[model samples]
Target: MVAPKYSRVVLKLSGEALAGSLGYGIDPDVVNTIARQIKEVAESGVELAIVVGGGNIWRGVAGSAKGMDRATADYMGMLATVMNSLALHDALQKHDVDTRTMTAIEMREVAEPYIRRRAIRHMEKGRVVILAGGTGNPYFSTDTTAALRAAEIEAQVILMAKRVDGVYDCDPLTNPQAKKFKVLSYIEMISRGLGVMDSTAASLCMDNKIPLIVFDLNQEGNIKRATLGEKIGTYIGGELNGEGDH
Candidate 1:
């Protein structure tokens, strides 16, 4: 029998990834594909949790830039994340994956309130947990939510599913000559301004000493490969994994 590399993990996703080519809103086909991949990992006895962003439906940063009330705009963004969570939850259920959607903000009609212990309880019972609502507060990104939840749950690693294959020195989309890093230290990520994640989220993960794997979800089986430790993506860790002060 094949074994997973990490017993437990937090899968972080951006809403744009679910948008597909339409460039907005939930794409059921994409959602289903990701759900199937998540189901596969869960069925393998590797506990899983997810943190989703809402850049596709709404972007708090964009709104704030447009002069909207930052707090109000952020709250709206959180609601968008809830929508994405519910969509993914439905897709996972269609795949027959026992899943729970937990939100940092209260939304009893759709999801359970985020409870650290209860969330762990659900994962222990072989259910995939989806965390949404972006820390239940403004001024925090979903990346921070992933880091905070991973630390609270003591997850072994964070699987950051992105459109890009891995972390690079420059944006690969614009810089054809960009260099991709196979691995990096947290300090390096911070100094390089890699933009893999926001500074706050990266700092939280660094402080907690949690490792993160950034990989492309477009490639089939990458999720499974990442969970099974196939060495498919760029791995980021603290000083222990590379040279840098934590």
Candidate 2:
């Protein structure tokens, strides 16, 4: 088997990706497929760390718009991520991949609280680290959490697993004529509000100079392909300079 290009990577999985077509809660078959892919990636010797969003079970911003306290709703969203982390952990274990679920919140019963050193140690030991709980703060997105965690762990790249194939100039579902970018600078993504991630997350990545690969998650084996650096998605980095201009 060919070696992976990146030794360490942070996989940012949208909660919706875990929900499958039903679009709510966990889907066993979907999670199992994801676990099998993760197993392949892990066996390839890539140090994998995952950050899961809570949008499938709870969306804090949406709740806040409906008169709930923003902080409370955000906390609820964090808890939802914990559930996802656990489900993913279980599925991965069935594949015989050693995994650990670490949360930003202090839920000792369900997972270990997030500790930078411990998380790195787990990855170094070849155990997949699942990071959940959204930085343990209100008004912070899971995307930002992924950025902060990836920086703290010094991951080589952030593999953003999206339902969309890549970054498009317009919503592909809404506009069939939308232009897809094969490569984009961070400035382009942020300036265009292309929604690769929230602005806070984008700025964090830019300042750290960590590259991001946004790709379609539903495609079988895509995670392994991304980890192996097969160029299956839009490449967002500071160094591209439109060199491989599409």
Top of the candidates by TM-score? 2
Each prediction's TM-score against the native?
Answer: 0.97, 0.97
Model 2 lDDT, full chain set: 0.93
Candidate 1: which pairs clash?
Answer: none
State the lDDT of candidate 1 residue by residue for 1-246, as single tens digits.
679988999999999999988899999999999998898899899999999999999999999999999999999999999999999999999999999999999989999999999999999999999999999999999999999999999999999999999999998999999999988988999999999899999999999999999999999888989988887779899855332211
Off by over 4 Å in 1: 240-246
lDDT of each: 0.92, 0.93
Query: For every model in order, what is the number of clashing pairs?
Result: 0, 0
**Residue-wise C-alpha lDDT for candidate 2, range 4-121, written one tens digit per residue:** 9899999999999999998999999999999999999999999999999989999999999999999999999999999999999999999999999999999899899899999999
Which pairs of residues collide in model 2? Answer: none
Q: What is candidate 2's CA lDDT for residue 73?
A: 99
